[model samples]
Target: MTPRIGLILFTALLMQCENPVKTPLPGAETIPAQIRQTDCFNGGNALFHAARITEMGNRASGTPGYRRQIDYLKEELAKYGWTCREQGFEKETPQGPVRFVNLRARFGKTPNFLDPVRGLLTCHIDTKQGIDGFTGANDGASGAAAILETARILSGEPARAGNLELVFFDGEESFAEHMDSDDGLYGSRHYASAMQQPLPKWMINLDMVGRQGKKIRIPSMTPQ
Candidate 1:
């Protein structure tokens, strides 16, 4: 169930707590000038879709299927040169603390704890529990795949120097069979606190990337 208006505002308050920003790398640039500019984001979009579907089959966390999903992702991302780290946290709720996971993929080492990252690209990897194993077909995997594919496009470019950061978050699915601030998006909330990533110049969160006729509804009637 989606959060009510009051709950939405309340969660926004929690998430808005001034995340400490990381400094930028010297001579850092946003986009590469040499982009082929020919719908390159499309292939990345496709990869995101495929991964989303595959991951949806499992990934409820603490399950064998979830472990397999994490292993596959770690291996695939390593091929792209990201230093992957699996940081685990436990979230508190009425039931007490529940374990959660987050996967961080860094391009290079940072001067401080959090890299002075140019961009933050993220997608949740966990599927919802009540929906036939949540084949998250578009919920979590597409965004992760998009970031990975984007990394390839950014290879050797100045933008990638301290340029990109990708996170495949676990527990985006809430506990107790549904999502709410108390239960869901736990991985991101934990990561933001633990690793302290720099504020991304741009953040693009993608879901349901492969759905036909996908239409995005914006808040305040403004273009995102």
Candidate 2:
């Protein structure tokens, strides 16, 4: 099984609150020049999309904002010749039963529903509910933006190695003040239950991946 890539986009607020100035990595100049080039990751492009998503306000599950976010993803993916669909499910939440949609996209021929895909990339698009001024700028939007950029680049490439799916999950955040096991990850849980075939061996989960002057801390956790 191929190892999954997980991206965490820490919020700029977190960086600012923690420290205004970021600590520079030691021997940074020893790194390849291409590594720092904007064209490599196109972080500027990702940031633009992130800004647009943040403008939509809170994207809590079943809300208009969340629906709009889904629509935006569909449109963008389609533009890259990727077919997209929404898998809808209802979950019991603190407020009530809420509908969540997992937005999925695939390039090239649609794989059979029962066939196993080789790679799957995922990110949560829903923002936490009831938090004032919570736009999920870094938590949700940044990850989505990074996914968009990745999709754009991959879609334009001449060769792709395997059958791949990009998933943007909703209802990842808890509606209540604090999250318990049952309160969050509704979309992913539903997807896991609903799949009829083997899950992709390689899954890339992205979150909290974009913020200026912030160094990402990569947890030494990868499936063996």
Candidate 3:
């Protein structure tokens, strides 16, 4: 999945908020009108955000660059009326116990707005460890940019935006070269464990997306 694909998917999901049916009926015109009314997702803006993220340098978990990235994301989300909370946790990894924080955003001004949402849009924000000069332009930044743009567009549709959550997961990359049960996905794992009952109906996880010439492949076992 490249950035363009991610943007398309996010736009389509928001369209569904207006129409929940799986299949579109004939002469359905509301979606087009909605698109025209709201600020459309801008590919140029997303790329600019991605570039800004990459400029922060290495974002390996527990690093200064990672902290900067988190702060930047929070600032950007706040401008669009998103209230973000840090889901901080400590995990024992192969290297040692590391502190990781997952940023969760909901569309509102209320601090205690813990409502049951319809969907979750997620992406990993940490770059691979032990790599020299690894900016993770496509892997880490692109997905975040896509989500940020989605949040901006959704801000105008409070009714629809309230039924969704945006998450930027940390420590998604493993300390070792390869991932295993003991490593990787630290933030997401903790979040899933801590979530209350009646979770979001669906979730979309984006990673290594937004690269030009990249193609998205669906698994064979995916339901229709």
Q: Which candidate is the best by TM-score?
A: 3
Which segments of candidate 3 are over 4 A away from where they belong? 1-38, 111-113, 215-220
lDDT per residue as tens, model 2, 82-107 = 77878998889989898889998877
Q: Please give the clash total of every predicted structure, in order.
A: 3, 8, 2
Give stretches of model 2 more than 4 Å off. 4-40, 109-113, 158-162, 214-224
lDDT (C-alpha) at residue 56 in model 3 = 96
Assess every candidate by TM-score.
0.66, 0.78, 0.82
Off by over 4 Å in 1: 1-56, 93-97, 108-113, 156-158, 195-198, 213-224
Whole-model lDDT, model 2: 0.72
> Model 3 over residues 1-224: C-alpha lDDT tens digits?
33344445665743434553343355522212111223576555677788889999999999999999999999999988999999889999999999999999999888454667778899999999888888998899999987887898889899878888899999989989999998998989998988886777667888887765445465454444
Distance from true position, residue 70, model 1, in Å? 1.7
lDDT by residue for model 1 over 80-199, one digit each (tens)? 455677888777854567677777777643323255665556778777665764566567666555555555544445344345566778877766765665777788787777645346
Q: Which ten residues in a row have the lowest lDDT in candidate 3?
A: 28-37
Looking at candidate 2, the ten consecutive residues that score lowest on lDDT are 28-37
User: Distance from true position, residue 22, model 2, in Å?
Assistant: 12
State which candidate, 2 or 3, has the greater TM-score: 3
The lDDT for every candidate, in the order shown, is 0.57, 0.72, 0.80
lDDT of 3: 0.80
